[model samples]
Target: MTEPYHIDTSSNWRRQAVEDWLFGLDHLSPGMREKVVTAWVSAWASSSHERLEDMPFSPGENPYRLMDHVNDVTRAGLDLGARAAADWKVEFDPEVLVPILILHDVDKPLIYGREGNAGVHAQLFHELPHGVIGGMLLKELGFAHTIVSTVATHATNAPFHGRNLEAHVLHYADLFAADHAFRQMGKTPLYLRHGR
Candidate 1:
């Protein structure tokens, strides 16, 4: 059976969130897998943010929580990677891709401010950006170089992207997820939405 790429949150979304992340990390070797799990838990515990719902889908949109955005991207990326391999004969390292998927947008809370329930990116981010911030944070937490590189470059259309196939996959995957979030919001008129 094929694993799902998208999650529709139930009442127990938090436990389901853990399961979703673990699914992405399942491709890693045992040691690295343990390390990722440890860091993920540590980051969540140590983070100043209270809940994923506080973070917006983007600096401009809040159709969903930051958690929703990351989960969507991870699922999309994994599915895209699989299709790329089977349909096009292009292959990427799943070990490399999974960590990148998990960490790619994890810095939304750190790089943006919580004004109520929305993520408003700081002025610094217009220059330095979340990909850079997220990369630095993950590296300090003791991630490998490839994962760092991939996370740091995964921003859509950022300069560091397109440097390699892994980066390309991540960049496009982010776009796909962001588009998904925006479309969800698009169901209602923008004026009716809370965020402008």
Candidate 2:
């Protein structure tokens, strides 16, 4: 395990996972980093509890924190996407794809939060999955339209016109990361274990 990040300000403990993940991205511009961090900060602020931002999708299912899962996906997605894209001669841009991977699950906190030992989850993202909510928040936070669309469609099963290729990359990348994270903990993800 890595040592905790040392934030210089008083509001240190809040959203440390998100901050640690964001600070690791040196490829992003200062403005972009700020925007990404701000999106998470806004999510945390919108909630009542402090730990909601770190909550996993389901304690019984997911084996890692939501932020950790997102990080793992992003970390794996970049390399995997690039390699796969290169082999297929597909155009893959990191600037466009990285943000989508990082922010794909930004709404997980809004969806599943452990409110005082109760199964308290948000219904605001009921009809609209976390991808749509996170995409909206990302757009309002000044991300590009393509980025928002990829994030939105990542969780949506149906296909749509004007959808960017990175959307599929992100969608599968998330699946790969989820399965890997679960397997790391000696658990099968979505029952993908061979022979059950």
The candidate that wins on TM-score is 2
Model 2 misplaced regions, further than 4 Å: 1-17, 59-62, 115-120, 156-163, 181-188, 191-196
lDDT score, residue 1, model 1? 11
Clashing pairs in 2: none
Per-residue alpha-carbon lDDT of candidate 2 for residues 13-96, written as tens digits (9 for 90 to 100): 554655675523665776776666777766666654476434665445444666667777787778778787878888776667
TM-score of each model, in listed order: 0.73, 0.75
Residue 71 lDDT (model 1): 75
Off by over 4 Å in 1: 1-23, 42-46, 122-127, 187-196
What is the per-residue lDDT of model 1 for residues 7-47, given as tens digits with 9 covering 90 to 100?
21233544444545454666778766655555444444334
What is the C-alpha local distance difference test score of each model?
Answer: 0.65, 0.65
